[model samples]
Target: MKLPALLRRRAEPAEVGGVARLDRRTKNLTKRLHPGEVAIIHHSDLDRVSAEALVASGAGVVVNAVRSVSGRYPNLGPSILLEAGIPLIDDVGEDVFTLVTEGDRLVVDGDRLLDTEGAVVVSGTLVTTDVLEEQLEQARAGLSDQIDAFTLNTMTYLREEKELLLEGVGVPEIRTKIDGRHVLIVVRGYNYRGDLDVLRPYISEYKPLLIGVDGGADALLEAGYKPNMIIGDMDSCSDAALQSGAELVVHAYRDGRAPGVERVESLGLSAVVFPVLGTSEDAAMLLADSYGARLLVAVGTHYSLVEFLDKGREGMASTFLTRLRVGSKLVDAKGVSRIYRSQVKGWHLALLVLSGVVALVTALAMTDVGGAVGDLLLARLRDLAYWIKELLT
Candidate 1:
């Protein structure tokens, strides 16, 4: 008789050992992750950002307490980890958290998680490329249902926040003047670093109002640009960024419970509380648009259906509607970076310098001083030729 589904054996496991780094929050855990450490996280449907961070942290193996891919949507995180040659042990159960402490020397042999004593602490499915692909396919099949949910949530928010969406009534006022200026709102999302690198020229030339959404404030700081205004729930942003003299806008719940305000106050900083029902990215857009920004440029903001679903937030629905509201003047920086070749190139600068030198020479040649300078330059060349010839001989 065939075995039941629960009784089925997992794929043959490979043995890999490292000191375990445990954190229920993947983002927080990533901060402490060192090279060759085992990352124990509880992130379900792991998003791209967290996955990329883990990969960058040089995590040797990832052990998830919950399902990495729940088949709700095709999230790109697990695929990234696999592609980075990082082994992933999936659905190891939350008991692993209680069973294993931080810095425990654990060995992941195929499906079994073992301790230094060779005792099986837990066992789970060793996720391979083929297994991940199958899960992705199933996840893709359910995307349509997710779209329906997204649309329904959008409609509900539209009905409740029509005044804020249509007229920008509830947006808090800030000291930074955005009138008739370009505004760059960064979110530290997909390809944010690359996007920011390409936008350096744009940022330099336009000098747009810089608005960092949560962790994006640190992104800007890392890129060597100071944000003029920092907006978000204040959870992920660093204390350094909050104290960087940027105007702080606390994105609060519609009921006026601004949790971020507490953090800001503890840091001896004041902030403008903008109470609204949406993600901070949405609020930033609405704030920029309402303030008469001539152009709104977004970096690392989720736009596609898969991206919205990958975020795993119902607030993404608000982001969708917010994009539509600001789509007229808003430009996704990723697309801009793809098409926006810097107008200034090396050859252009070289030709400009050559032209300036030529003009200076021509102008000097028109005077008696020019003839003397030319003769002196010719004598120096002749002397250099003579020295080279003497050395050769």
Candidate 2:
């Protein structure tokens, strides 16, 4: 098969290897790499954050599964890869793993890099001085727009929160009024879905107040749980979920006007709008604290400087301030999947069957099995009939 010109140069290659560092985020996936390790930069969310991080880390090359958005939208990730002098391999497929055996000499042929085993080597790179300067200039040019967008979004969210607080609506507070109660604050991003899956079983045990922030509300509803309250500017939220009996809180700026609040009112849903000076997540945390929550658990919230930057805003100041206001009550759920074990296992099937048998035996002992089973089945049929009737109604 004819290969790209870059790969042709590596027709004769050697072998080398190291720990396989897989980067799903555009942050520096290779920042922690040792001198000779191979960095595999997987485009997890296909965001620029992971790409930027990989470039800053200075890996030898970067194998990307993500299409570079056809070079539009100022993809900092691929730009970083190219400018950092890192070899870029596009769509090398899964077989590329065989060529990477810890420490193999690899050759970069355009978007394909192959090792001695004739497999592709995945690596990443760092942003060199030249690329850094260019990136800075771009950032400087876009700073004003970034700030304006941040301000507008912040104002929208804050107004919603103020209205919520002023209305004295019986919305579930972020913190528990009852001592020892826990509050789970959910956001959508990163490994959020995985984290929520891990935390699902504990929901019933801890009985934490479920508060969904924006898209997090849909996540909760999808997981078969209803949020006690929903907070944010109401962007990226589903209409059905917003009207699912959860109290709505819109965050707006201190100017006392909130467009999000207007929308909430237009929907005929009463919302408490609060004016705050930070991100919607920040406002949510602060409101949770003010409402007397005992403990706050944060899921999928941005934590690092790069992540904050990825939000395309000067979030550091507000995030810092928000943390100070609620740090004592905050517990991050990052990597929670590693810690929280699922209670149900494959072995539970036998127990479930046994329980069913026991119930059947008890029914047989109390009454005739034939009649009991027939009656129980009829009851279920009646329930289904009612559901159908409701649908028609």
Most lDDT-accurate candidate = 1
lDDT of 1 by residue, 74-173 (tens): 8989878876778899999989989999989999888789999999999999887677878888988898989889889999999999999998898887
* lDDT tens readout by residue for model 2, 216-295: 89878987889888888886577887899888888776575667877788778888776665667876777677677789
In candidate 1, which residue ranges exceed 4 Å CA deviation?
Answer: 1-13, 338-393
lDDT of each: 0.90, 0.62
Off by over 4 Å in 2: 1-180, 338-393
Q: What is the TM-score of candidate 2? A: 0.49
- In order of listing, the candidates' clash counts read 2, 58
List the candidates' TM-scores in order: 0.85, 0.49
Q: Highest TM-score: give the candidate number.
A: 1
